[model samples]
Structures are given as C-alpha cells and as structure tokens.
Target chain A: MILGRVGRALVVSELVERLRDRWVLIITALFVLLASGISLYGRSAADAQSTVTAPSIVTLSTFLVPLVALVLGHDAIVGERERNTLGLLLSLPVRRGEVLLAKYIGRALALCLAVGVGLGVAAMVLEPGHRAALLALIPPTLLLGAAFLSIGTAISALTRHRATAASLVVVLWFLLVFFYDLGILAALVATDGALSQDTVAWLVTLNPAGLYRTGMLVSLVGTEALSQMGLAVALPSTALKAALWAAWIIGPLLVGAAALHRRQAVTG
Target chain B: MKVQLCDIQVRFGHLLALGGVSLDLRAGAVTVLVGPNGAGKSTLMGVLLGLVRPDSGHVMVDGRPHQGLPRMEREKLGYLPEAVAFADNLSGRQVMRFFTRARGLSRSRADAVLSRVGLAQAAGRAVRGYSRGMRQRLGLGVAILSEPALLVLDEPTGGLDQQGLTLLWEILSEWREAGRTVLLSTHDLALIERRADHICVLHDGLVQAQGSPDQLRRDVGLPVQISVTIDDDAAVGALVAQLQRGGLADVQIATDIDGRHRHLVMETAPDDLLQVLRIVDGAPSSVRDLRVAEPGLDDVYERLLEVTR
Candidate 1:
C-alpha cells in the first residue's frame, strides 16, 4: 500500500509535468480541433448523402490515437535518462517498476483525457441522437491508445536515446497501422486468393491496429458485413479481439518494465 | 548512519571502474571522497545510492545490508547527483513539491526546504530560468527535504559561487552537528580540508589512503616548510651553506630579483620544526621575516596519489 501510494504520487507528479508542457497542450488542442472540425464537416455534408458515425470516428482514431500516444510515450524513459534526471528520480526510495508503471499510467491518463474529452465533445455535436453509438466508441478508442502507449514505452525502455526511440516508434507505427492491412491485401492478390483463411485470420489479429479496426467494425456493423465478403467465418470472434488488445497493452509493458528494472542507472 | 562498503568491484565494458574497494563511512561526521576524474568516485556514490549494483560485493547501511533495507528505510538516505537536471517546464516550487510528495512528505515541508535553501523567491520561476548555482541549491533542497540520516552528494559544489559554497558548508556543518552522516565526493581539497572529518583518497579505482586530514599528513611523512627572508643576499648564502653543513637535507637559498633580499627555505619533520626555528634564530644574519607552511590536504592528497601510482 505504501508502494502504491508512492506510485500514485509519481503519477500525480508526472501529470503535473505533462500539464505544464506546451507540447502536450499543443497536441491536445490539435486533436480537439481536428476531431470537432471533422464532425462539423460531416454534419453539413449529410445533404450530399455522406454521413459520419461511431465507426467513422474509430477509423479516424486508428491513425490519430497511435500518433498521439507514440509522441507522448516515446520519450517517457529515455528522455529522463538523456536529461540526467533519471538518476535523481531513482535515487529516491521508489522502485524502478513503480516508476515505469506510474509513467505509463500517467501518460495514458493524459492521452485518455485528451482523446476522450475531444471525441466526446465531437460526438455530442455530431451525433446527439446516437448516444449508444457514441458510448460504444470510447472504450475501443482508449484501448487502441493504450496499445500504442505500451508499445512506445517498450521502445523507450529498449533504447537509450530519444531520437532512436522516436525513429523506432515511427517505423513500428508505419508497419502496424499503415502497412499491415495493405500487406495482407497485397498478399491475397499475389496468391490469387489462394491464401488460407486461417493465415489471414492470424495476420489480422496479430496487428493491434487491425484488431481494433475489425473489432470496432464487427461490433458496430455486426457479422453480416463480414459474411457478405465471405470472411465472417474466417475472422476472430469479438472475445478474441478483446483478448488481443489486452495482450497488446500488457505484453510490451511487462517486457519493458523488466528491462528497465534490470538496467543500471547511468552515472557520471 | 554508518555505511560500510565491502570489497566492491564494478566494471564497465572493458574498463574496471572499481576493484576491491572498501570504506567505512562513520556516523555523525563528514566523509569526503577525493580523487581524480574517473577514479570511480561517482560510481561508488552510485553504489551507495542503490543506483549502481556492484559486480561482486555488498553495501551495508547502519549495519543492515543494502538489499535488506526496505524502501521506507532507504527513504532516510538522500542523494544529490552531479549536474542533476530537473524538468525545465516545472517551477522550482513545483519540482520540490514533486520530490517531496514522491518521498511522501507534505507540501509544507517542500516550502520549508525551499526557504531553507534560499529558493523561496525563485520558487515561482521555472527551472529553465535558474542559473547553475540556483539549480544546485535547489538540488540541495531536494536532498535535505527528508532530513535524511545519510546524505550523499557528488560534486555538490561544482557550480556554486563563494556565497553558495559558504551556504553549503554551513548546511553540511549543521547536518554533521545534528548527528547525521554526510558523505560527499569532491575535488576541492581546500574545501575538504576545512570540513572533512575523514578523507578517502582514491586513484586508479582503489583507495589510496583514508584518514583525517591531520592523520593523512602525519602518515605520509610530509614536512612543514619554513622560509626565512634575510636582509642581504650574502647572509642568505651564508645561512644556506651553514644549514647544508648542519645536515639539513632539504634546504634552498634564493635571492630576490633585486639581489638584496634572499630567502632560505627548509623542510623539516613536524617534531624538528622547533629545532629548525632555533637554528634560524641563531643564524649569522638576523631573520627579517619568517613563515611556516604546514603540509595541507592538498599536499597529502598529491603525495598519496603519487605513492599509490
């Protein structure tokens, strides 16, 4: 319980630091403006037969959330280390694991407030009648943000330089969010639709972004959308998607925390 | 509380940082670790802070093994690392509050410490605006916030001005007087000579010598040098010849630029200082001026380092 109290204090301190960071303010403002602008534009375009809903917001977040999370979390460990403050922090009574956990949770909380409040405001303005849909979109979006935060934290732990961590997070983002589905599609085309359904299922579930996208679509649109494409039977169930998301959040974080715990604080 | 390091060894890649280094840091005294750069002074402090794990040894804090000390017990030890940097975005007050809260101390304690370090006026200003000495003072404030039993600092005076240095000395003296253990690493022999109760000379990753300043000079057999200035060069030459004939092994006579004033310099053991003085008193030329310079921490440090090398 004392350790927990210390962890909470660390989280509070981290949040205070982040709140004072101009870059965090800029990022939050950008997200709110972008999301609200998109929602308003979609509302006016309803007469043109185009509509935006919870799934549209989820699609937007698939790209936006990971970008924000990566930017916020990539420097969590290595930045402190490079700035020479990690030694001072660790010199206190808190354990290394507490620091890592508190850092992740604190950064995640900041991301959640930004994305949740930003999207919540946008959803209220655009979909005042669809309260159920708006509520359903929040969890998956936050989960997706957590996935990337954890991944970025892992990158931070593995690298000792902020530049290296930033670069690796970018590469990882491109691979998981942008290139993953495209690569799967290219594979299907290259194989002339001969790729096994099980192989396709595994590949989609393995990518956190892909898993989030499919889970959101299946939850909002139901299995009928998959069935029409003859892909429903091959896709993972909603439970499996949730499990994969949980795994994405936990796996890298545990590994990163372990690495950080074993690391020697850099001394002059 | 006392800290005992036992056969500590640390290696970084192909380099050996510390090898079989052992030290006893007594309670209620100021222990200064002095060494050249890369002599593993920082590494040893890091070990004591639990920031660096030894390769094959252990540290004991107040007779308890370092690993056996719980987080609550570790809280009683404070550390100020060399050139420590805080978040530039946070104000000095905010930074102190963060650390105080992290140590589970209240916000009032943070304010108390800020005032103690004379940072209360600057507490509202962001740390990015702080000068080097101000930042070092803030670091000291954070280290002392918990009233730690063992306070460890590495190069704490690196950026301090004369006033800041004086303030630091006063704080250290207060801590020592409070029956707390103060361990610090410094290259400033002048400062150490005045404040250190125990001095450890480290070189090549090993302890060269360890003792009080006086004990060190005595053990090293460094002598007090007595310089006598005579009214005339001829008298100085005569005195040098007489002292050389008198079996004074270390003696030199040098005429000033005008050739009118000459200085006779002699190095004698502490016990023979009076004998050398009597010899000078009985010299042919009456001494115009005389001065005695004892071997200080600087001399002892250099001699010990040289001998170990």
Candidate 2:
C-alpha cells in the first residue's frame, strides 16, 4: 500500500521506548539543571527580570534541544532495520511511510515532554508576569527540536548502519546548530555589509534555527529589538514562520519515506 | 484462505532472486518450503508478504488477482522473520500490547497470547532480559496476536527448545484444526517433514518439487526398508533361507551400533512391500516382530536434488 494509514500502536511504542531510554532521562536532567541554574542567579524583585531568565531558557534550549532531538531520533529507522523488525512490521497493515511518520511523532512527543517538564519547574521561581512567558518559550523550543528530529529520522532512513546514522546526524547538528548562524555571519561580512537588508532577512529565515530566533525576538522583545538586530526589513510574518517550522518538521519525513521505499525495492 | 503466487518473478538488477515461481497454498495444511541457502525461499516469502514486488507475475488471493496482497489483506497474514527483534527496553507485556493494538485486537488479547505462548509468568519482565528462546516465543506470540488466517514464518524453530517446539506444534495443530494456511521455510527438514502436510523444495531459484510426503517418495521411487526381529539368533539364517526360497533373497542381519542386538533387514520397492512381508511371514515361529520403514522425506528430497544437480 502506498501512503497507507499510520499505526497508532507504533507511534505509542516509539514514544514509550524513548521515554524509557536512559538518554531521555539524562536530557531531562540537563534541562532541569540548566533552567534552575539560570533562574537561581537571575531572580529579582522587578518584573523586568523575566526577560532575562526566560530568554536564557529559550537560548539554552536553542543550544541543547537539537542535540537531544538528534540523539532521540537518530536510531528511529535504522535501528528497526538493523534489528530486522521493519520487515515484520510491514507485514501488518502498516506502510513504510506510516512507520516513519509514527516514529517522528512519537519521538517528537517525547522531546516535547522533556522541554515541558525540564523547564517547566523553573516557572515557580520567576514572577507572575514572565512565568507565562517562560512557559511560552517551550512551544518554540519544541518546534526547533522537532525540526532536528525530522532531520535525524531522515538521516536514519538514508544510512544503512546505526554507526553511520549517528555520525551523520552529529555532523548535521554541528553544521546547523553550532555553525549555521556563524556561517551566515561570515557571509554577511564577506559582502562588506553590501548585502541588502531584505536579502539578509529572507536568508535568515531559511534555517529553522534562524527562523526560531527571529520568531522569539519578535514575540518577546518586540519589533524595535528586531530592527536593531538588522533583520526587521521584510521579515516573514508569524504565520509564514510557523509554516516554515512545520515544513522543517514534515519535509524530511517525506524524504525519509521516499528513501525507505526505494531501498526496499532495490534490496528486496 | 487460499493464496496463489502465480508465475512470480523478482530480479534485483541482473540477479534473479525468484524466477518464474508459482506456488499454491491451501487451507488446513502446513506447507513447508525447504531449500539450501540462497535458494530464493525468502524472496518468495517476501513476495507473499508484499515486501517484494514481482517484476512479472501477479498474486491471486482467494481467486482475485492483486499486484501484491493489499494492505487490508495483509492484516490477515501473520509473519515471523528469522531474526525476531523487539524493543528491549519495553516489557514483554508491553511489546505484545503494542502488537495487539497494531492488529486492532482487544486489550486482553495481549495477555491471552502471552498465556498461550507460555509467557504469562515473564510478561512483566523487560524483553532485554528474555533468553533467545523467549524472544522467539514472543515473536510467535506477536505473529499470532491477530489469529490471522495465514501465517508466514521464516526459521520458526531456530532458537526454540524442545518445549518451545512442542508449544509451536500445539499452535500449529490448532491452526490446522481451524483450517488456517501456514507456510514456513526451514533448514530442519527431518524434524518438520512429518509435521508438514505438504513440502515444496526449491533449488537455484526454481521449485525442484512440490507434493505430499507420500507422493514425493513414490515419485522418487526409493526403496522401503523392512526390519524383522527373530526369536533366536539361529532363526536369522532360517528366515534368510525362507526368504531366499520365497524369491526374496536380498536380506542382511541388522545390528545395533554395538553389534549385539540384531534383526533381519531387507529392502524392497514400495510395490513389493506386501509380498516381501508375506514371504517373511511364511517363517512364522522364527519371527517375533516386524516393521516396515518407508523412505524418509529427506531421502526423497535428496534424490530430487540429486537429479536436478
């Protein structure tokens, strides 16, 4: 069957498996520590301190969620293939696309939980005005992690071995999370600031990480901060940015499904 | 349900994994596919499961042609691969529940299959703690969670102990009684020969032979062995002489490995078995017991492969 129905059982199992993993516990603990550490030292009587603590949480997740997401999803498909469960699973009513999509959703949910609980407890330390803002940081954090999870699943599909998937996902995480903005900065400097502000604004939205940064700045800090950051001219609207985030989450799953189908055809 | 894989041909580039194969699987029968490594048995199973799309021929299920078995039809099939793997972190019960949900079975069925497979005690244990045999039993449990009409198993007995084998036989017996179709591929021919209702032997990407056990033996025309116990060792000669006088001269004394226990053994064509028995019966007082060993399935399979080779 082509594009058959997704198996909810599979999605649930993937979620359960991820939740049971030791690495998930470790990531959650790391988030707890990071959120607590940032909130512990940044507390103040004034409500203006909310921006400082909440933005730090978002920034930390921006740095850490991709790593956790890639770690969670790197084995989603190749692990099943290596274990030889994929063939047996396909013998059921499930299709190849269904399995990949289910893994994506399942792992994404686990990451969402990690972001929720890991940073959620810190809301007790902050004042009422920004506690909601601190909570608001979670949705975008999950979106950013979900985009990486998509890329990780696709990497799992394209590679033959888990070792290869692990390495490839790390390389992708490094390039996208650690070096993407840096590369963009280098490109802007190479042009001697000759690049149009509109072009730079459009270019910044191409990366999911960059788009997340833009959305966070606009939502929390206002348009004045965005114009000061020099990406305010002709930046994408919030709806378009959400669509881009969704595209990041879904496009790679499609590519993973295609790769899965082609591999079965050639190898069977 | 009846499944017909007609004229199926699958090619991976220039190497033909399955070439012009047609197989008929009937209800209430255990049809076994036996072959050497790389004999296209797995490729054929893959086609049956819709994992491999045949380049040429189509599949017909219950007389309706299909590109392959449709997704809805696949729900009727229970497949067990050679390597049965599951999420190690999950408990055995959780794994079964997952499959139970995937098959759209009732919630209680997960425990029911665990009980049926003799895994009720270990249901709460993590699957990583399960032994190889337990894992195989779990795989079988998952395969049968839906009680599918057709079961396709690859190397079902790989890691099974004797008790596991007995449990499997019991399940297969139930399937037979229910008139479900079962197809399995294995290297253990001698163990499964008597249990299987029909045997299909594949060689070099083609079916060498397919038939009931008796039919294959008859087609191969292998000799039947007759063993007789005499009252005394001296009667061995008398029986031999009596058989010689009765025009059945080819007889030898069969001895155990230690050469202490002995019996008069003779070989005859299956058609001549009755006549040979009559001749041996002619010497009545000397004979204590008698038995006839029909040609074994492995022998017939060997002869068939020999001819093809």
Measured by lDDT, the strongest candidate is: 2
TM-scores of all candidate predictions against the true structure:
0.92, 0.89
lDDT of 1 by residue, A88-184 (tens): 7887778888888899998998888888887887776664554456656778889989999999988898798999999999998898889998999
**lDDT by residue (tens digit), candidate 1, B81-103:** 78877888889999898888788
- Off by more than 4 A, model 2: A1-6, A44-48, A185-201, A220-230, A265-268, B226-291, B306-309
Candidate 1, residue A125: the lDDT equals 63
Clashes of 1: 0
Pairs of colliding residues, candidate 1: none
TM-score for the A-chain in each candidate structure: 0.91, 0.93
Please write out the lDDT profile of model 2 over residues B1-309, one tens digit for every residue. Answer: 889999988888899888898989989999999988878888888888888788889889989998777888988999888767788899999989888878777879999999988899999999889998999999999888888999988889988999999988888888999999999998678878778998889888888889888888888999889988875677677778777776654688876676555688888788878888777777758676788888888888888889988
